[model samples]
Target: MEGSRRRTTAPRARPAATRPTREAGGTAAALPDAGSHGPPRGARSRRGELDGAPAETPRARAAPRRAPARPRDTQPPATDGARAAERPAVPEPQPPADPEAPAVARRPSSRRGGRSTARQPRAPRRSRRERDQLMDVLHALRLRRQETCVSANTVNTVVTRLLRGLGNRESEFEGVEQLNTGSYYEHVKISAPNEFDVMFKLEVPRIQLQEYYDSGAFYLVKFKRIPRGNPFGHFLEGEILSATKMLSKFRKIIKEEVKEIKDIDVTVEEEKPGSPAVTLLIRNPEEISVDIILALESKGSWPESTREGLPIQSWLGTKVRTNLRRDPFYLVPKNAKHGKGFQGQTWRLSFSHTEKYILNNHGTEKKCCESGGVKCCRKACLKLMKYLLERLKQEFQELDAFCSYHVKTAMLHMWTQNPQDSQWEFTNLSFCFDKFLMFFIECLRTEKLDHYFIPKFNLFSRELIDKKSKEFLLKKIEYERNNRFPIFDKF
Candidate 1:
């Protein structure tokens, strides 16, 4: 190994594709030192003779021109020199790791003194004065409507409240009082465990209602399940459905029941700004003239008539006919004061809905109810007539059928049974010895037959009627002689 020796030298540098930039001389280019000349400046004479080539300009040294960009599908010519170059020498740029920070601090356009305040919205706040103003308007409206709707019940309540002293309820509301409406949520509003919507409703306590009616101050009272709520609030969430439901029910009632109205004149109202109401006026064609219907079903005896005493209420026909019925459908009630209670409640008679007696005339075999001097009685016919008239006024065919046809069928069925048993109960039982016949005459077959009523043959009318074959009328009014009695009716 020591004996082998070799010398190596780098290959000669080739001309670059581009020319090098000339370095600037600090002062001036010196002429080559006298004996050390390399080659003439900017001349290629001696170096060019070694290669035997002519000298070229810098522009001529660049790579030869190539074709323009081709579509990728075309093949490019292979080159061994480029493929043999293993490593890429050029470097690519890199991105910064921290991108958020700004390269330079910026001076704000507006200075501290010129800055604007931030804005925000606030909740509404009404003052005491504003609240009082609103309440005043509402209170005034309520007070104005009260006078017209002054129910006897309410009037009585006012009177009672006055007598008992309303505690501090009389004081006017102060402006400083602040109420949070949301507090009701905590106050325990509840639907009653009871199915009824009301614990009790405001109602007239004393008077009872009749179908064909009479008018006067009346008071009502009853127990019901009322909702728990703040009485002060006009409408609360829990009560909204209640008020709506109540009005719906009332409208349904108007659609169903009620009869003719001969006259309606009312200035009174039940609510402020007047919502609809259940108002009825006395439009009855028949008016009750009798003070009472004398019915005696009581264990207690009827009061003996005394000249100096108060008139005894005498209803002769009505008696307690059934056991006490809890059902609402069976019959209406009469108070114990009506008559002393018997097995059931003793029935006391009222001329309340009765108008005048429905007197039917029958042919006289000298028969009569023996109500001397024509006892003018009041009856249900007037009520029925009034109801029919109201229906006619409203032009309601449905109501007309309900009252005149359906309701009357039920009532006629009721009244036709047992009837009043009027004679024996009212008069002495001994007085019924005279044939027990009610004299009925003049039955009208047509609604237009008011001008002419054909006579009905009662025992009395049978004798009075002389039915001859000719001309079909009585020749002379005949008489079955109970002729001994004075003919007071003849006049």
Candidate 2:
């Protein structure tokens, strides 16, 4: 076994190329001779040999010498085709230029589709003193308008009498309650002090409401049981209550009544298509415009779609939200133009009464903003926002589609987020105003502002407001916010 192990462990001879050559000093060199031809067959070159083989011919020896090894930082730029091809194509580094030298403006790059633009520098924000002065001016303007405008008492008396007379003449409208709704009633009226919205709601019992669209705002109402001598019965096409027929009858009655009352100068405006209001121009010392809307007050359960919304639960408390939801909802004679056939006659649901209640009693605490209580800027902020929207609309005719209602809805949503009355302290009016403007800008950017009452209804409907107008309004809002609203300067 020992002899067999010795035979198997014997050392093999090294390749001729790998065998170390003895020099004059008996030093061993593993490399083959550089001047020699290719190594003999069956022999391999040593580790240090070029290409693991000796230079075979004169041409091989004369091959171009390799460039000297250079530090990465000091490497010369590639110039030759072969060197350039071997390396990545990179821009040549230019010498540093004078820092103070004027920049050379190159033509727009073709790669970028020739679009090269720079935004204009925004105007500096107004100083605190300037803003304060502006606020004073705004206040003075409000007072001046109120002073010059038609007397509210006279307007109210005239509208009330007219509505009463119409109700007396038409049994259907009898016992209809008059609700002063809109910006004027909400105490958010700005420039249009004379404009008033009075809704004459007729309570309709045993009515079934079906949504006209996915938006909870509009509905097709059906009378489950038409009461004897029911005034609304004639306006119904089958079981469905026709908004068009009801509004037409209401407008005709208002026109007839306006003619009989000679005491006050009142002229009914030409009816506009899709308008729910019977607009009357009253000249009682001064001209006052009143929009009398016909609404059906329905009591019972609120719509199922509204169950998840009215996030006021957090702000106004669960009890308050429950009470609000329990309140009867009103439906106005507002129809969509895009609605086809009978669907166009659908009435829009209105929570103006709810809104008024919420706005009037907006404080987290009951006495907030009331007499002998801490003053809050909730109404003041709403007024300012409404004024801004009105002024913008007047300035840019393209923004005619935008209304104060959008701003009002935004303010309501803003209140829910910051429910405490302290957040809207009178002292923080400027800050609150700025925050509201920011919210407006955000709504414009996203274009997804939900109706405060009906979350499903998008106040910023694409059909009503086009994309171009929205973009234009966004820029205008930013401009006004950055620069102290130049639009208000005229006032």
Candidate 3:
């Protein structure tokens, strides 16, 4: 037996590669395959207890005792039943048993039957972008200008005209008296809210003119100062009351209550809000009211001891500033209306129709009834008549009327150049000055010229400075003064 056991141990010592091939017909090969078929020792203990080697314990094998099934329909709902009755409380909900069908996910809850699902989180909100730096800068600059209030430039042309509209209306309120300080002034101040103690101090900047043709940038300027009642108050109140009347009356007369008049960008602000305290309203047209205000203040108003002319004539020559002259670009030969590109002639005809409609009508009776305020805006009226004259000149093939204006301007220039040698010679240019003046004055009287003639001609009369020329002009102007054209009244 010892020898046999030694042989068995000796065989096991050889590697399986050398001993266990089926070709060698070794029993070790059969042993290995048998071992593969059976479970390992530990695996058998786990599997066998329930399924393979060992039988189940009597306790585990014994079938569990299930309680009797309840009749669902006959049973009262948990809410209707007594607390802690037959079935403890809520029946636990069971998931359906089909594998192919999707399972409804249940949320956990402390209560026996309750379930709560979690909610999805929302995305975060984004912040808004800040305002543009340039816009903020501009706004700051404007506010600073307002705070400083060194802008006498606020009292524009129409402001002055509106004031003129108040001519003598404020005379009842005007009387010069020296008023005291703030506390003292306030103590004397009347309690009536209806009555405003008016005052206006316009520090009109000396008009700055770069050239005859440069268009400066539009300025939305404002001004402010303390109350200086008497004359200043009169001026301020006159301007505001007049301005309000001007705009309101304009809308009323024109029947254009809603027309925005867009080409005219406008804003009228008072430093002290309503009625009067250093008020300013501005409109930026190709040319604006400030220019007119300057003109009126300078050449149109009663003579000024402190200042000579309105800023209009002060900035530009009287001839250039007044609405007297025609647009040089809008020129056309007489009978030129029939040509292919005669916009000038057409423009003139347009003005002619507009003027006739405005001047001939009793009041707001013409076509374009919506624009009846056309008559009230002397500038518009003048502009219309201006074109009409051009049309009449083209229709008659006689633009010599305009030539006469050129001649008059040229004559004054020449007379100024050499005052001693200056003399009227109607023979050399038998477009005689007198005859030209005669036809020119007639043209001015045409419904087209009605609006612009008086103001323009008066300026000419006032500005003709040569003594010899003045004397000669006076002889022709014998019946008039201030170089006023005798023919203007006749026209």
Q: Which candidate wins on TM-score?
A: 2
> Which of the two, 1 or 2, has more TM-score?
2
- C-alpha RMSD values across all candidates: 52.0, 27.2, 45.2
Best by lDDT: 2
> What digit string (tens of lDDT, one per residue) describes model 2 on residues 1-491?
01101111112232223322311111111111111223211122222222112332322222233433321112223343334344433322222322321121122122111111134343333245544755774585474555434467767777778767966774567767888888777766666467888888889878898887576778889988887887677888888888998888888888887888777888899987788899989886667888888889988798876766677765678798888898898888898657342355689888899888888889887888778888777888787777777778877898988887887787777776666665565644554565566556556755657777677677776856777888788788767765677776767
Q: Quote model 2's TM-score.
A: 0.72
lDDT of 3: 0.22
Quote the lDDT for 360 in model 2: 84
Taking the tens digit of each residue's C-alpha lDDT, what string does model 1 give over 1-491? 00001111112132223111110111011111111122211112221121122323223232233333222112123342243243232111112212211111111223111001112111122223322432332233232333323332332332233223322233211111111111011111111110000011112112222211111111111113233452323322232212323333333332222222113221112322112223232211221110001111112211121111111111112121121111111111222121232111211122111211212311021133345532211112222222322333254332221122222222222222213233112111111111111000011000010000011112112222222311111110011112211121121
Candidate 2 pairs with clashing backbones: none
lDDT of each: 0.20, 0.64, 0.22
Model 1 C-alpha lDDT versus the unseen true structure? 0.20
